[model samples]
Target: MPERTSYDAVIVGGGHNGLVAAAYLARAGRSVLVLERLDHTGGAAVSTRAFAGVDARLSRYSYLVSLLPPKIVRDLGLRFAVRKRTVSSYTPAVRAGRPTGLLVGGGEARTRESFAELTGSEREFAAWQGFYGTTRRLAERVFPTLTEPLPTRAALRAAVDDDATWHALFERPLGELVEETFTDDLVRGVVLTDALIGTFAAAHDPSLRQNRCFLYHVIGGGTGDWDVPLGGMGALTDALAEAARGAGAEIVTDCAVTGLATDGRAAEVTCARGTIGARRVLVNASPRELAHLLGEDPPPPAEGAQLKVNMLLTRLPRLRDSRVDPREAFAGTFHVAEGYGQLERSYQQAASGELPAAPPSEIYCHSLTDPSILGADLVRRGYQTLTLFGLHAPARLFTADNDATRERLLAATLAELDTHLAEPLADCLARDADGRPCIEAKSPLDLDAELGLPGGNIFHRELAFPYADPEDGQGGGAPARWGVATGHPNVLLCGAGAVRGGGVSGIPGHNAAMAVLEEG
Candidate 1:
């Protein structure tokens, strides 16, 4: 028989969120144990040498640091660092047989000029500023509430104090809001892209889940800026894991939890290795996964709609428009075939079980922003890494055949990219030791199989608004005000499936710790 142990709290899964919760709980003098199934931690927020025999350390899954709260970093004393991108985003366009594009975030003057050039109207630029200005105000009001107890919707609305901002973001369709605000097709697509990232829905979908997803993406850290991690994503999770260990948390990898049972006094967790009893249990797995462990029906399946591609490039590809330097354009988000109409058609195609001929995707060159991801030898060889995120490729399309669909999608995506490039993107290939080009594509099914992501949904499931629903009232045996509550009092969610729990942010973990401490 396996030995059984006891702890103040036990956290399942060793993802960044679980580590964060362990750090906070252990720091509070509670004996905590974190169990991870994988040999390694970090979960999706990991960096690896993806290409065999290549020295480039690519952020294999989750990249960038935007949603991580500064309070968590400061309180935990994490040593991670993130650098801001000099160039925000660049979208390729053509006018009069001349290479032209819209560039944002380099300079105020440059952004204004690019917007005017793209739209042929200064009014559109002004409207763009006005629209974001509203979002900025909304972010300011909402971001602070994330770490605190969930506020009632009425209370949050009062805090926002702007009916127009509330209606535009929460009540109205994001597609309608973007289309009404921005005139340029590219500009509109750029804004709408945030709503669709990792979410499988059209901007106009009445479910309003996309609105919640967009809110989290934009309100992250209150600036909505997706900054590059200095030493790749691993640095961030490593710091969190170290902090948890320093706080006296017992972290056990290669130990997978198989079942969880909770009584009024204590919770018991049975894992592959042994059974452990705790005063409380914190789950860092997705809601669906949690339900399976509890022998309950899972929530509605989540369907992810994105394709991830990682590549090591011999050199940056030349752009069709010679006026813009490749380095500057690739420094930030490089939009490819993401015009408004193109995005709509891509979604339509994918929804109909066909890969879009012209897929909407975005690429960013990490080395251009932070060369630390590449080894000294690779850097000297002028090699860089490109991360591509293709949108509108839903998981359902790949259900029949993942390999064939992935290849077709990748081929179509690269071909579409060639349209805007002076040379074929494949021409700038860097070969691995085996002489194969350093390129890898992961479809939604691939993500599901590799990352244990249900339906490959990165956020775990549809995002929930941070604020409490007013209609829920104080009835129906509602769990608690912390948003980490579950049907079982001792089993709290500390992962992306919790309310306000998406992204790389440790908000859910922090809140879960707070919940346990408060209950005691």
Candidate 2:
């Protein structure tokens, strides 16, 4: 017979969310046990030495930080730090022998000059400021409410205090909104990319899932800025795990939870090693995974649409536009083949089961922002790390022939990158001890197989509005009262699948803890 341990609460999964929940519960003087399937914790928010014979630690999956709430960071007393990127985004648009690019957030004069070069007018730049100003206002109001009980649609709209902002973001299609606001196709694509990241949907998809994704991306801590972790993403999770352990939480790795059952008074979690019982069980897995563990019919699997590529470059690639600095261009998100028409064409192709001719992707140089990711030797050698997220490559595209499709998509993506660079990106790649280029590509299928993300969806399932939408009846029954409610009373969701639980944020974990503590 397996040994049984009793705790006040049990958290299944040791992802960032699980760790967050464990910390909060244990800190509250409740005995907690966190079970993880993997040999190591952190889930996707982890760092590893991907290249052989290289001492560089790369944030293999889920690289940047933005959505993590400040309150949780402070409340948990986490010691990790995040560094802001100087350049927001740089897009190269070389036209007829004229080398020019759109640079946002670098300098006021430079940004206006870039906009003027691209659109032949300064009005578009004014429009850009106006649009982002509105988002900033919306973020300020909505972001603070994430950690609290879910608000009704009317309450949230009233808080925003701008009818146009509410209608444009909540009711209208994001694509239509972007088109109406921005004049340049590239500018529109940049704004719309937020809606499509990790989500497989067109800008105008009536489902409005894109809008939710967009809102989350832009509302990070009310500033909508994504920052680089000081010591890779692992550092952040390590701090979280430490906080949990310090609070007397027991975290067990390589302990895959096989089954979960609740009997009103206590919840039983059966794992490979043993069974644990607790008054409350917080599920930190995807909704689909939770259903499977509970022996219930799983919901439709969420499909992840982005292809992630990690590459180590011996040196930054030279850009065709000689005016812009390569270091600055690659520092932030380097948009590649992400024009409005380009994105639409790619989406249509992927939807039809065909690979996009030019996969819309963006690349960020992590080492440029945070050199701590590299070893002294690697840094001295002028090596840098590049993480590319390819949008519109959904799970279905890889179902038939994952390897073949991955290779095709990668080649297409690289070819697209080569268009803007003076040299092929592959040529700047660092070599491993085995002479293999220090590069790897992961498809949606790979994410599912490796990280246990169902259908490789990073956000777990399709993202729903964080607040309860009663008019649409979207939020799973009684969402406005508590978004983390699992309807089982004893079980609660504390993962990305929960309401307001997408991104690297620990809102779900914090909310779940609140639910448990409130009941007591």
Candidate 3:
């Protein structure tokens, strides 16, 4: 139970963001209550032993950590950390019936060589240097603002201070930018994967939705490095929950918030257990769920356009490209059939409600970087974990038969991956004690039913630009100072749906707490 009829603030969810808010608010001495639907916290940022009788603990969903501000870590005194991968990404390819790939991040010189080797010229490599250099600069300018008050579009633009870079990143379609910058289809696809990770949009979408997704991916930590949390994703959330509790926040699990009512100044949260009141309400859920809680009609349902598959492998799979070692290639993001043409073709197919013949996906071997996630015995026996993310597999495709589509898509996606592998992934798969392959695939619908993600959209909905559009209002409205405000005076959004939110970042949670503190 909440242990109080009323509190200074009530959080509707106990995901990472919710825990972040609770930690911050409670540390500030505010009476805060966190209500979680799941029996545990962490939400999507959780690690579990998925396979029966398996000792390897895998980051089940939302595997990587980026955009989690250092300020939040220090402020909450969370006992957590992340390790960067030596190689950024490796995209395997087959050209002229010969195996090849582009490997990013082994120092600039090596990356340049890889690009040159793939494109047969230094032209693409030079362009790559310039493109990422600009994004690094933009990230430096834009990332710090996420934790602060909402900046007007002009203010952020002024801070960015380069019209050409600004126009390319914020104004035009990311797809167009990619086409103009890179000539190689594989290189272009590798660059655009960041933009379409969880987003379903074409490169030339006039809405510039892809641009927003691109910015989020690149601006993380001002360096855009997606680090692996040391103990898997759950380590961060576990630390967050502990920090929240240590600061005196009350967290009640298995207590679902059934309804909510607010009068702008005070609010009441009705849950599976009982109703509790608070002077302020902070919702760490999707906008759709928040609207329903407020008794308002939610906007059109958000849809997730990705497939997640987790596997415990007996050993790393050998690659078709003999130039690269399996340990080095698997340590970073491994791109599969994600060439520029392939991505567009897949998106077009999925948009028309059909699976692509060759699905584009990326794989990460977490145990390669941090073997602590696996049991000591498993580690000694050459075990590893593969966390795969298949792009452009939207929720709509599963509307008819979720399980069948998931299985079909998984099979197709893996088959595509095998095209660049010396061996089928199944051959490397470890079997559970029960003699079952330690593999599980999740579709958008499965995520929705299990995680309550609106249409399984990870960002909750379309991500808004970190900066507020000047036409929208002054500084995103006086009330929306931290991009966490709602129509109600006492209610705020502190979830992935918040402006400048999403990722494993606690920016929204920190902002929501700051908003409450400032109001008082």
Candidate 4:
């Protein structure tokens, strides 16, 4: 064994959440260590040199940013290191069979302009305002407090009693809810897109609580607009690494964590590098991956398998006959949803175990927004860059069943773009696979089965842990019996899998830190 190094806590993955947890623990004067499987940190939240000189991010995988909490950004002093920009979705009206306009944050003036264009005059805008307001309140009041201590038993009961006041609202499908609110197809599509992103739910799934997860971005404050972190998503991770080092947390890259060594009191983590002992080990890898490392059931609880594919494009996709202005080109997210029918079919195809033939893609053009991408020489080389993110089809579709599938997916995206964009996507520089992520090809599905997780679920346990069963101690925002502290007395869980749902938010780590401080 190498000279054993002891620490207060050892975070397993160096993703944004892991880094956040490390920083919080170190700030409290505790020795912390972070281990990353890849050569660099940030897990899925990263930027790499996919092409020479052109630093691009796997935007197609885990793209978009509004879900992160503002408190973490301000508290971590990541204001300068990681920043946000305004981005919205633009879809051509007639080209894709119908018009799809889902714009997120241009300004007060632009908001008015967009509202006037919608079918309804006063009633439609008023309803949108109501939905946005309600969604914002839910995110701000409910989500930020997710990691905090649960309410008392009586409080929990009372909250549920009150919740019954809007039983129909909670029970109805998000699509139904949106339809009841707006009359215009464009406006309806815009609002409903919120519920559909990252979700495999059918457009008419009655159980979908898009307001629960989707609203987190619409009104969680700090300019509800989505933007790319400067340089690449990598800059955000690099800043986290910098913060971890600054706060006295030791970080080792190119080291993969294989298993947990639990002594019933503390955990001794087994890694490719060796054993790392810590009072508590926070896992930042997806819940699925953590489960794999633990060697238990796959993908914990209710979350389904996460299949991601990313591609680097040579030419920027030029939307034909798009309503979005050229100046606001890179300021919004782009989607290929033509209407509700198309959206429903996409989900059905994925659910049926087959990939979508005409996959819906989420596009982000880094070269269009970031000035650093326009550096000399590379600009001369016509090195325009963008990311095309879409659904993962059947794994069987790949060449090696894995290798060729990635290429096929990328090729399909270019073919789709070629049909609409100004110039066909050309330069094929790099590709990343989220199913088999990092250098070792450690997949989320493999992680879930190894860990005790239910379905290779990555959101940890399930998204509805607190809201689902009343018998569970977490009912109505009440903490689990485990609370922030782990089953082991000396250990604590400070990763996204811990609480408040998932995202780049540091709530799990921040909450765990408070518990440790209180325990001391």
Candidate 5:
């Protein structure tokens, strides 16, 4: 082992959150260094020249960037490095044996106005306004504080009470909130889809506060629907890396960490290159990622993490309608629930720890809207980039005899797309790393075992409490004792795998830094 080089802080994994933590800590006058497993920074939020001659977002994994505290970005001076663009989602009705754009310019205003126009109750619009206000306020109040350590008891209580969070946020599932607010199926559907983006919950599941929590996450730059990072999700990470360096944080990439050496007061990170020591060590990768680095000494988060199956496609999936809102049309986020029941069934199947026979696939295409990349040629080449996401299911489902479940899932997704699109996708389909088809998918269960995620569940801990668990009571709050942090005293935790569920939001990293600062 090389001589132990010491620093104020050492962050493992150059993912966005880790970078965020390092930037914040360095700004606070702490000497910091970051180690990344990949050759480049930006763990999941990376763009690579892996696909074509062009550098498109490689994974777009955990797709979309929302709920990231803008204050953090500004504070770190990350504005110049990152770019953002909004993508709209379109769901055309297969009416009259053809697909019809739901929003037709003037038609949108009419539809929006008419629904709320009648009965003196603009329920949908009013609900949307109120919900956005609530979430926005919540983000402002909660996100900024996450950058600091967990507040004192009085501070926590006062903050929660002052924000009226107890009344509005306590134990509420986002689905129920949406249903109560809107009478229309489509509006509720959009919100539900957003809530369940990277989660394992069903849209109608009662314990879906995490889904509600995800609202703040998906509400990235701008409004109305989710936003994708400009130039693909990779740009966001690049900006973070730049900001971290600007803050005097050193970054080393392609150096995978093998284990952690700690003496209770400080942490020594053992990577392929050598061992680097720091007063504090923050792990920005998923819990499993951390476990891989720490080996068996420091246990991974109790809650399991999921495996991600990423696909960089040559063409876009064909949607049923044309002339849809180009923004919504190009927007990659999709709510696959044909109706509420389908969503429930899918969740039920997932809970039984089995991949759903007809898994609901949330699809997105970032390359469609981003202008700098290849969109038209992808179409001309008979393809457009697409990603299909589903909940984490049982590992045995993949290994079971006959593999009936896997085949069913494979058939269901393509068959459902056929129901919505004009032509079959068989021709546009190409090869992938999975070899089964485009990309053979992996569930959270498989990810936990393979990637070293502890619980076979994503998020270091549950984001939405009240619904998260009654027995443990480790839900809600930015900082809690005995959770989300690295079990080791000096080692810290970050990433979506941190507490409060997963997404591209940098809260975990921000909070982890605050925790270290507070401890010091």
Candidate 6:
């Protein structure tokens, strides 16, 4: 028997974006086939029983949900859902030789008190409210346009309506805005963390890369709130796969795409199983992967900066600050050594080819919000999961020896975390069936090799502002209305590389499907 040799659309890579495209195109009555290299459909968005014999299922690579739009959910009839955290974030600090922390949820009054206590003034708290108020407006105006076409820089500026905000976010370095807006170093760092999640940049970088990262984080669903998926990250991908299949799209796993060819009207994709032809090809891989498949030279390389660690804890560790409960603090992002000055120093160290003496990181406990990820037995036993994202640890750091650097960096990171804990983090470790600590760490290099993320960049490349650049159409055809256009008319980028793409949002996938439909 032979597999089908053709489809109306052949999508390479089976990540959530690819799944979205398949569902839309299939629903539109186009024959769609999705090819995934891995045995599973989910790319980095997966849930796994990480430790041997562990009953807890952890969102291994990419966790949390903030960018996915409700429109996509309704349009696809997805069964996925997310729960908002009661606490936004908790940053532990030692003030006036007293162990204290700034907690940013519960209520406006409580957060204000924490801010006042930290700086001995309410100035920063007022600034926090004002800065966020401005961003909130910007988010509302800009987020709605993502699923539509890409707007020119001038149009987007006019759409934003506020010249000050447009310039602050689009034109100037994010660091300058943060420093000018917030007086407290810790508060400034808290605001800045949103800009540096998977990005490697200083606040003052002239390129404004941090600003681009900051926009996506703050504009999620127009609220900037990062919610926890009811299941693990895999659940979202699973729902996407279901929607796609139900819409009559064929999904084939373990089928690696080797090459792609197009003649401006039709395309052929070579995969491990066989070659398939299509009228249009939608790429769910990165720009580099797309170029390689098309036999074209890739652009300048991009490197991701972050260290990821997942742990199954016997119990949540106690915080140095006794006022806030561990559950409340861990439920939201737990900031460690991420003071404004500390973050800058760490970035400088990493840029100069050395590991940050004290790495900036954040921890989150998904179980507190949704216990379904853990087995009933583990839940009854008070076991929980903690995911750590360490900043300033780029792919370059582990190029020489990924294995050794991971161990050293993991140890140092945990040790730094221990300094702010009542007991060492190791004390809360849950042992697996084989007597091994139920824990794992991944550096940028590890993620690259495992997930095929070029240079370990999660967003595929440095994120560009959602709007079209001034040079967008200089190559002479109409500007990419959907931001998914490629050199060949029959091919389109449906991944994070697309304009207004990045995060778990399905904007690119939706836009790609729209492009194909409009062309047809």
Number of the top TM-score candidate: 6
Better of 1 and 4 by lDDT: 1
Give the whole-model CA lDDT for all candidates, comma-separated: 0.87, 0.89, 0.90, 0.56, 0.58, 0.90
The parts of candidate 4 lying over 4 Å away from their true place are 1-4, 52-60, 79-87, 95-105, 108-123, 151-170, 206-211, 288-317, 322-327, 379-383, 391-400, 403-419, 426-461, 465-492
Per lDDT, the best of the predicted structures is: 6
Per-model TM against the reference: 0.97, 0.97, 0.98, 0.79, 0.76, 0.98
User: Against the true structure, what is every candidate's RMSD?
Assistant: 1.9, 1.9, 1.6, 5.5, 5.4, 1.3
| Candidate 2 C-alpha error for residue 329, in Å | 0.6
Which tens-of-lDDT digit does each residue in 457-483 have in candidate 1?
Answer: 988887887788744221222236778
**Candidate 3: tens digits of C-alpha lDDT, residues 126-209:** 998899999999999999999999887899999999999899888899887899999999989999999998899888888988
By the lDDT metric, which is better: model 3 or model 5?
A: 3
All candidates in order of TM-score, best leading: 6, 3, 2, 1, 4, 5
Which has the better TM-score: candidate 3, or candidate 5?
3
lDDT of the structure predicted as candidate 4: 0.56
lDDT by residue (tens digit), candidate 4, 141-218: 444444557554355334445353234234556677677777866567666666544444665665554544454445
Model 3: per-residue Cα lDDT at residue 231: 88
Which scores higher on TM-score, 1 or 3?
3
Off by over 4 Å in 2: 1-4, 97-99, 470-480
Candidates arranged by lDDT, highest first:
6, 3, 2, 1, 5, 4
lDDT: worst 10-residue window of model 1: 470-479
- State the lDDT at 413 in candidate 6: 92
Model 3, residue 485: what's the lDDT?
70
The Cα RMSD in angstroms, rounded to one decimal, for candidate 4 relative to the true structure is: 5.5
lDDT of 3 at 282: 92
